[model samples]
Target: MDKLEEITSDGVAVCQPGLRLGQLESEARKKGWELRMYPSTLVKASVGGFLAGGSGGIGSVAHGGLRDFDTVRAFEVVTMEKKPRVVLHEGPAVHEILHAWGTNGILTRIWFALTPAVEWMQLTAAFSTYEEAFQFAESIATGNTWTKRLATVFEWPIPSFFTPIKRLVRADKSLVLIMIAASQADALHAAAIAAGGEVTFTGAFDGPRTQPLLSDYTWNHTTLWAMKADPAYTYLQCGFSLTECREQFRKLRERYGQEILFHIEFMKNGDGVVIPGAIPLVRFSTEERLNDMIAFCRSIGVFVANPHVNYLEDGGRFRPDNIQLLAKQRYDPRGLLNPGKMISFRKQVVTK
Candidate 1:
């Protein structure tokens, strides 16, 4: 276990990469501090893997993702050079290996930013239409009154898969799922009413009628539920600016309609405005059709972060990240760590 070294007067905590996010969060809670942000996979994800994968999850709506230069203050990574050296990378240098899929170096320790912990209420709301639910979620996310940790929207049938919450959810209504500070409970209820939706479930995770933590039903976990219901279904991760997202969602809903069940995680973009990170459940017909769907979205200006592929370049950015390649060349001279995950490195091997 990496020592839970100094937690400064401010809430920052420096920890070993092997530390589980949940474990660290638990420790932080004892000190009245908590991780400012973490993916929904907090239970199983490690600080190192979270940084390496450069993923965004539950808290992303408020604090943004790991790629933000400030998310990680520093890192100690071990290179794959013949003798193997532990090098410290700080500030901008951290970006070189971030989201590289661990193709370049082994992350050993990390300096994480922390904040005061808040007691959040797990809640849900239902709407007659997807647009209303999405609007309510956007309102809550953008509302100055509430500190939202999670704001998710799911179309009608998708909520049915959340079996534990089935009794709380109705069959045909679209849904809005949220985790917000307990202080803002009334505000969320009023917002839901103003948006013309019903506040359906409002309580804690282990209340009298307990249900799975609301975070479990957001992000890619939603895909897991759909997949379990039917193995043939696959999902996509796409990001669209707040302006374009609403329009794109309307078009897809009108075009594919029920064929593609709508789901979105609302978050603030770099500019601090609300944007939707969409993970619409697709009715898998064929691989070719999936590609066509992705292509069509790109043509319409939607940035699809393809999740079906294993290669780093073929994923989120859709091309070889030159920065990561350069870092690999500098730190992993032997190409010994996580080989073949970086397409550019593989090409370098072929050329040399």
Candidate 2:
């Protein structure tokens, strides 16, 4: 099942769902093409798992997310019934199972859209303050002059947890990690310096690389590093309004202080508008305090996709999409797939 079946003339990759994203990427690169977006767990994440559970990661800065219409071209699904039926979903219909957490149907094969590959460079910029690092990341995300894949900011103490890169990171400095097209490395370096940041590290992002790819320090991996350092740390998935992110950042820092370590990933939304998404690590104190912090974030107009919950609706989406519900009814009518994860499934059954 872990096979790269074909790469179409138009740059589409037709592959088995069991293929690891890292493998797919390497194969794509061999053909001078690459996936639009992939999760930070690229080395271990399977195509089927990513389509079922992930939202966005590395390349999201330029391509939005896997859920975006253009990212996935098609899905070959198998129903979970006796004498199961094979179905091919194309275009927007693929969203019916995208991020559905395998509760809709089993994905057998998938067709992913690819783009011409670019040599990317991984680098980090250190700033005197977290705010400056954040501003610099936002500039790279929203600016069109430079083509970028990742733009992440790690607030002071958060960088301390990345022991592998300790040599490049200063104890007192906030950090901005970036993956930009190698062609724009000079431009990005000049911009960082002009914005009062120092380019602390830079290296080739492709080909034979170091043990820890710089990407491992981003997205949810940021939380993983913090947790590895101190198990007391947990995280929250937040989406700050693009227009109000700067103010939201200020408020969050003032309100939580060291209680919550700020980490930001800048990416485009479905509509192609750049937004600041956060996976901030919270110092676990009490259940009550955690809930209170979540409420405080909501009160401030920052969207919290609570990661502490297990239910599908309670996590990122907050509510099940009607399309996903309808598809579930058709593909997994008995609700045998990932039972109990989709709260809406039980509710719909009760209502019926």
Models 1 onward score TM values of 0.93, 0.95
Instruction: For each candidate in the order shown, give its overall lDDT on alpha carbons.
Output: 0.79, 0.87
Whole-model lDDT, candidate 1? Answer: 0.79
- Tens-place lDDT per residue, model 2, 193-212, is 99999898988877324454
**Error in Å for residue 133 of model 2:** 0.7
What number of backbone clashes does candidate 2 have, counting pairs of residues 3 or more apart or in separate chains? 0
Clashing pairs in 2: none
Off by over 4 Å in 1: 1-3, 205-211, 318-321, 346-352
Top-scoring candidate (TM-score): 2
lDDT, residue 85, candidate 1: 91
> What is candidate 1's lDDT per residue for 101-213, written digit by digit as tens?
78888888788887788777888889998878888888777776679888999998999888877866877999999988888877778878888888888986432123567
Q: How does candidate 1 fare on TM-score?
A: 0.93
At residue 334, candidate 1 shows an lDDT of: 68
Residue 178: error of model 1 in Å? 1.1
Error of 2 at 175 (Å): 0.6
* Local lDDT at 328 for model 2: 79
* Number of the top lDDT candidate: 2
